[model samples]
Structure formats: structure tokens, C-alpha cells
Target: MRKSAALALAACVAVPAFARTDVGVSIGINEPGAYGRIDIGNFQPEVVYAQPVIIERSRYYENRTPVYLYVPVEQQQHWRRYCHVYRACGEPVYFVQEQWVEQRWREEHPGWRRHHRGWDRWDHDRGEHRGYGY
Candidate 1:
């Protein structure tokens, strides 16, 4: 954790803050006492650290309706399993926010969709995924 925190801090501090050159929107950071810096983009995007959810089967439907989501059995990364066991043993786990994990993976590897083959392809023939509307 110490190493990871240090590395993350170093990476953030090392980032090149290129002045925004494109015509973009900017959003100010919001906090109780501290102000957040401007975020430039078409839409405002942010993430909050929600509590870790545990599941006996890890298969829970939304309390409201058909918006079904799951933690794929294949996604139990080594660290995740370790954390699950650690928490089971009553240790507090402060994990990174896991929302939009599916979206993030899709964004990074748009060429491949989850569990699909042949009938569809992420056509990068235009040098970008048409799904991304480039």
C-alpha cells in the first residue's frame, strides 16, 4: 500500500498539465470547504467511493428492477479474492471505486466485446471504434 500510494502520488505529480486547446467545457470542483479544480469536457464525470458490497453468490439484481449487473466469476482478480478473504476475517477494506469497470474495459479494448465472437467486430477500419462514434 505504501509503495502503491507513493507511486500514484509520483505519477500524478509527474503528469503534464497541457493547457486545454480544444473548445471544451470546464467544471469547477465541489467540496464542503475545499474547491475542486475545473474539469474540461462535454459532460461532467466523477466517481465516488461507495461501500464494498458482499454477496453470498455475488449475483444480486437491482432492488428496483431489470437493470441486472454482476461481478463476473472471471474477474475475481488475485487481489480481489485476497481482499474478500481479508474482509471475511473482519478486516476493513478500503478499495478503489469499482463503478463503470465494465465501461472502462470496453473503452480500453473496444475491439472485443464481452463473450461475443464472429457476428460482430469492433471495426477500427476508421482508426477508431464506430461504437465510440469517432
Candidate 2:
């Protein structure tokens, strides 16, 4: 009975370890939840703050122009702590308004649909995929 209980507990733990699935989604510029430098292009972006936020001041970036970014609200507020994530610690950053980013993404990818390819093809095999209009 003790061996069976121990085996059952081991099986329970091992099952979850093997069943773990990691899904990596790369969010590009203008996409929802994307945090990085954004291409300003010809469109004027509404900024979150009027003044650019500079976490780390460096002489190297003095001549370089301030780049616009679309970062999370929390990251924008605590830029000093999160600037390294975007590799803009030594440069000036202007956080664009989230609403504007979403609007631009929708405009550009009017018919965008999430594509389940590669490892995500399991959904297609399981018949869980709703046709994405090809």
C-alpha cells in the first residue's frame, strides 16, 4: 500500500512536468502589448508625456534624436527600473499613447487574424481551429 501511494504521488507530479506547454508570442510594433521603439512614419503619434523620459543620461546619445516607443503604462511610470528591457537606458524615450498604438495597428492590419502555425498546429490537428479566412 505504501509503495502504491508513493507511486501515485510521483505520477501526479511527473504528469504535470511532462504536460507543461510553453507558448511564445512575439508582439511586433503597433501590436497590442508591444513594448519597444515604434516607427513614427508620417503619422503624428499622441504621446503619453510631453517631455521625453531619459533614465540614463549619456554623452553618446546627446546628438541622437529621441525615439518614440510604445511601452506599458507601468513601465513608462517606472522607466528607471524597466528601461533596460527595451535597451534604451542611455537614450531618450517618448512613450506613445496606448489608444493611438491600437488604432494604428487596427488600421494597418484591418483583416489580421491570429495564425496558429508550427507548434501551434496542434490546434488545427485537434479541429479546434476556426478557419482564419485562410
Candidate 3:
């Protein structure tokens, strides 16, 4: 009984120590600037469409970065289709709510220089994406 108990205890500690110390390390080192699924180069659209459901802009980082997209209620389907094209590439797509637009605006224009009262409020009422300058 004592021998069996000691053996079990030893395994509990030893097994984990040698389990997978190098499991998640090799992939990251081999493919620099790559996460589990995200492709840094493919994070943003290569060519901006004349009109799109959302204008997605992402800044690449070691970890996942928030995607700045503008998708309204009616344009949701269009956005889904755009995502489908990239699905085969194994890229993960994330959608930030409408608030992201405002957040982006604030980040770009810090401390308020005036002459921009309605700049933050986007008119999503228009079903078509203006592809407006961001």
C-alpha cells in the first residue's frame, strides 16, 4: 500500500513537469508575428472597396488587436460574406460595436481642436457604407 501511494504521488508531480513545456513555443518562434490563427499581413483589407458594409482597420500586435469596423443592422449580411472569403485562410474576425467608431475618433483627435461637433456621430441610417475617410 505504501509503495503504491508513493508511486502515484511521484507520477502526479513528474508527469506534468515533462508534459508539454515546448508545446506552444515552437509555432510562435517558427512563424514570427503570428498568433494561433491570426495572420498579421491579412488583418487589414489589401484594397479598399468602393463601397463596403464595414471599413475594418486593425493594427497588428503580438496578441489579438481590436478590429475597428462599421457594420450597421442592414449591412450585417454583407459583412458576414466578407468574413467568409477569409475563413478558408484561418483568420479570426472580431466585430466591435458602433462605439468603436467613436473610440477611434477620440484616439485620433486628442484634446479637441474644435470645428468638429458632428464628426463622431456617424449616420448609420444610410444602408450603404460610404467608405468614408477614417
Candidate 4:
């Protein structure tokens, strides 16, 4: 049953034949959220990966440096699509339900003259890939 299900999913996505069994899905939510989805042969769209983002402050490490991590979105033990770094052409990048990146920087990395913080996420979104970007 599991073998057929995985094969069915692959066929639905029109993916090259492979040997695998079992399938599943998962997702992650992070601040400065950015999200996107790609279609797999008109089948159900599934998230294959995402960026790992968290906000915290400490006296040790320089708070000025932005924290970045990769997150994985998956479904049916395969990847389907991923979110591109939300950007407005010449504008700075951002994520889902987001806009003011510069404002976030100021609030998070206060008292800093110029700080560099940014990243990009890539996705294979294929067969439960462990994809991430930051």
C-alpha cells in the first residue's frame, strides 16, 4: 500500500521514476515570514522547505548580526515547491505577512550604525528533501 501511494504521488507530480515507499508532510512558521508554493503537475501543492528564523537577544554575541537558518517544508515524503525571498524589485527582501525589513533591523539590532543581515532560501521540494536557506 505504501509503495503504491508513493508511486502514485510521483506519477501525480510527473517525476522521474524512483524507488521509495511511504510519504508525509511538514511545515515551519518563523518571524519575518516569507512563503511560496510550487505546483507538481497540477497535483496538490506541498511545501518542501523553508528558512529557520528566530528572534532573541543576549549580552554576549553581537546583537547586530542577524540570525539566519534554513527550514524544511515537506509533504508526502517529497518536495513540491518553496517560497522565494519575498522582494519588491529594487526594494529590500522580506517574507510572508511582512514588509518593513529595515524597521525590523532597527528594532532588533538597535544602536547599530550599519549592519549587514540578509539571506536567500532554495528548494528542491522533491521527495522529502531537507531544503533550507538563511
Candidate 5:
């Protein structure tokens, strides 16, 4: 009975260790579903709000130029809660409209899907040299 109880306890602890799983995906600038700073350059981007949103006011940010960001609508509405994610809690930020981001991505990456077809297969193979290697 003592051996059976100990084996059961060990199995309960070991099972969770083998069952744990973690997955992460990184989205970079100009990609769909990306959320971070965007370089507007000389051209002006359409923004969701006319004025820049300032979550925190401090003397340090007074002379700094405002940054443009492409964030989810929910994050924009709750800037105070999500500002730290972009590391712009105190800096002035202009949230670009989602429509503009989609348009710009389409214009800039017209052949992105076709060009990256083989790359996608290569990534799926986890760097194994298959015939689909780019």
C-alpha cells in the first residue's frame, strides 16, 4: 500500500511536467497583427484621433517628438494599462488608423505572399534542407 501511494504521487507530479507546453510568435514592423512604433518618415499617416495621446505628463517628455504607433483599438482606448508594452508610457503617441496600416502594407508588399511561399515551407521544416528551401 505504501509503495502504491508513493508511485501515484510521483506520477501525478511527473505528468504535469511532461504536459507543459509553451508557444510564441513574433510579429515585426509593417506585418499584419504587429503592434509597435512605426516610422512615418516625410509622409503623414492617417490617425484614429486627431491629437496625440499622452498617458503621463512629465518635464522629460516636453521636448521629445511624438511617436507613431499601430496598436489594437482596445490598447489605444486603455493607454494607461498597456503603455509599458511599447515602452512609451510617458512619450506622446499618435495611434495610426487600422485602415491606413492595411493599405500601406498592401501597397508596399504587393508580391509578399507569392515571394514568401517557399520561405514559409522552409520555416515549417525547421531549417531542414528540403527541396522547398529558398
Candidate 6:
């Protein structure tokens, strides 16, 4: 009976390790008091990180949502200008880097290379449709 109990305990521990899901979000730093900054983009945008960028994730509906930390003041101003020009504010935005998107895309769509340039196909198509009433 002791052997059976031990076996069951071992299985309980081992199963969860393999049953975990990958939500496609990761943190590069583990600093205390790190907080997610407000993001204003369709997807994660490419930027030069002068400081360590922190992202937070929460389970939303059936998918996980990521929030990106704010960039430096200068970078924020530049991005704000672009947002105003493109009318991309007041939309649901998640902070993600370009590389992270590419990696996730490659995993989902195997055999397809990352050829969409900086923005993904959705952003590209959105830009095209923005000229119309969208």
C-alpha cells in the first residue's frame, strides 16, 4: 500500500510538469517593483531597450494578455507622435517586441519564414484599410 501511495504521489508531481501550457509571454528581468507600462499598438513594436523591459500577463477570456512597460521618455514621445498621426490610440494594445511575435508565429506556422518585415500581416493589412472608414 505504501508503494502504491508513493507511485501516485510521483505521478501527481510529474504530470503537471508536462501538462503546463506555454502562453507566449516571458520576462527578461525579475526586479522587484517592476510594473507594466501602458502600450499603444496593435501588437508588440520593435524598439531599442535602453533599460530592462518588463511585461505582465493575465488570463483574459480564452487567451493570455500581455502588458508592456513604458519606453524611455524620448522613445515614448516618438511613438506617441506616430500613434496620433496613424490614429492608433484608444485601441486595445499589448506591449510585445517584434522578435517575440516572430518566434511565436514561426512556432504556430511551421515552414513559413519571417518575411513580414517589422509589423505582422495583421498590422500591414490594417494600415492598408486605415485609409477607408475603419
lDDT of 5 at 39: 73
Clashing pairs in 3: none
lDDT of 1 by residue, 98-121 (tens): 343445445656675556575545
Error of 2 at 48 (Å): 0.5
Itemize residue pairs with steric clashes in candidate 5.
Answer: none
lDDT of 2 at 107: 71
Best by TM-score: 5
Candidate with more favorable, higher lDDT: 4 or 5: 5
TM-score (all chains, Cα) for each model: 0.24, 0.57, 0.25, 0.16, 0.60, 0.28
Worst 10 residues of 4 by lDDT: 86-95
lDDT of 6 by residue, 69-115 (tens): 43334444465444343333433333344454445446656766535
Order the candidates by TM-score, highest first: 5, 2, 6, 3, 1, 4
Q: What are the per-residue Cα lDDT tens digits for candidate 4 across 48-130?
A: 22432322223533433322222233411222122233212222111222233334435665665443334322333344635
lDDT of each: 0.38, 0.76, 0.41, 0.33, 0.80, 0.45
Q: Please provide, for model 5 over 73-132, each residue's C-alpha lDDT reduced to its tens digit, 9 standing for 90 to 100.
A: 999999999999999988899998888887778777786652555556646857667787
lDDT of 2 at 116: 28
| Native-to-model Cα distance after best TM-score fit, residue 2 in candidate 6, in Å | 0.5
RMSD of each: 19.4, 19.7, 16.7, 24.1, 18.9, 13.5
Whole-model alpha-carbon lDDT for candidate 1: 0.38
The TM-score of candidate 1 is 0.24
Span of 10 residues, lowest total lDDT, candidate 2: 20-29
What is the clash count of model 6? 2
Per-residue lDDT of 1 in model 5 = 100
- Model 3, 1-134: lDDT tens digits are 99999999999999988886444421111121111222223233221233323234345332544332333434345655555443421223443334434443455556753355765456645556578853
Model 2: how far residue 68 lies from native, Å: 1.2
